[model samples]
Target: MLKEFREFISRGNVIDLAVGIIIGAAFTGIVNSLVNDVLMPPLGFIMGGIDFSSYFINLSGGDYASLKAAQDAGATTINYGLFVNAVIKFFIVSVSVFILVKQVNRLHRREQAKPSAPPAQEVLLREIRDLLRDGAPPRVIPAADSRTV
Candidate 1:
């Protein structure tokens, strides 16, 4: 059982998954920073200095100046503003992942579309085989024409 577990951990898929998970955790931090530090400030300014993080409904009867104030006062509040920020962050991460996946897929398609050339020895062997199969040697076309036999 221990050997099987070691084998599973050593597999390419498991290692790839571990790397992907670590990268994703790091990416989440970057996305959070982007949303909190970069995107939200300008967006808030555009919305007439409205801080989305402060937009919450007070469940507790106490009226507070801000979300932080309400929370500090032990008030039960619906933190919809924070939820909005979370949604925006989610979209940013989603679009980033989608674009990354799309580019990777495009590169894969390009690699698949390209025809790989056979080695010189293989090409020579194929030509010799053809020559032996027919009574005459294989006819060679000029370079201007397609070089394929």
Candidate 2:
């Protein structure tokens, strides 16, 4: 059982999956930063400086300054701003993954497009066999045709 478990862990697929998971976690942090720090500020400014994080509908009838304040005051609120932010993050991550997959696929295609080297010994053997069969020695052809006397 221990040997089986070790084999399972040592498989290429398992290692690849582990690496992918780690990379995905790191990429999620980058995407979150892009959305929160880079994209949101300009977007908020363009939308008349309305902070999307604070956009919420208060179900319980108490005036709250922000979503955090409402939550602190034990008020039930529909936090749509957070939902929007999450949706934006999802799109950013999805697009990034799509581009990464596309580039990988393109690289794979380029590798496939390259011509492979011919087997030198096999080619030489084939030429020798053909020469023996035809009862003629292999000779190089001249650029211009020459009449043999």
TM-score of every candidate: 0.76, 0.76
Provide the global lDDT of candidate 2 against the true structure. 0.93
* Each candidate: RMSD: 9.7, 9.4
Among the numbered candidates, top lDDT falls to 1
Off by over 4 Å in 2: 116-149
lDDT of residue 134 for candidate 2 = 91
Give the range of the ten consecutive residues with the poorest summed lDDT in model 1. Answer: 140-149
Model 2 weakest lDDT span, ten residues long: 140-149
* Candidate 2 structure quality by residue, lDDT tens digits, 36-95: 999999999999997788999999999999999999999999999999999999999888
At residue 113, what lDDT does model 1 achieve? 96
Task: Please write out the lDDT profile of model 1 over residues 42-149, one tens digit for every residue.
Answer: 999999998899999998898899999999999999999999999999999999999999999999999999999999999999988888888775677767646666
Q: What is the lDDT of candidate 1?
A: 0.94
Every candidate's lDDT = 0.94, 0.93
